[model samples]
Target: MENTKKKRYVLVSKTVLVERELWTRVRVAAAIEGETISGLVEKALCQYLERQAEKYGP
Candidate 1:
């Protein structure tokens, strides 16, 4: 059977300042988890949004 799944792509660019200590912690966690910093940040943001949505609805 032919593949039915569709590829997805999302592109975003932004610049934000973070405390040095927090940045260091995120970098270390990403390295230990074998994930890119961007991925880690995106995962965190998604989870945060989910929590907010649960509390506020949609």
Candidate 2:
């Protein structure tokens, strides 16, 4: 059963499929920065969406 109680926003797991080459690059960058691949991806997605909103008129 689904919970009906209100709650604060919380981080949740998500899956994304990418090319192996792209993932290799991300792995290297993430290792250098000492951050998980998911964290890097989330930041990148946020920035990309923000730029798109600015360019296309939110």
The C-alpha TM-scores of every prediction are: 0.72, 0.65
Best by TM-score: 1
Off by over 4 Å in 2: 1-15
Estimate every model's Cα lDDT from 0 to 1.
0.80, 0.76
Candidate 1, superposed: residue stretches over 4 Å from native: 1-14
Candidate 2 lDDT over residue span 1-58, tens digit each: 9999754432233555565566678889999989997798888899999999999996
All-Cα superposition RMSD per candidate: 14.5, 11.1
Q: Which RMSD does model 1 reach against the true structure?
A: 14.5
lDDT of 1 by residue, 1-58 (tens): 9999754433334557665666778889999989999999889999999999999997
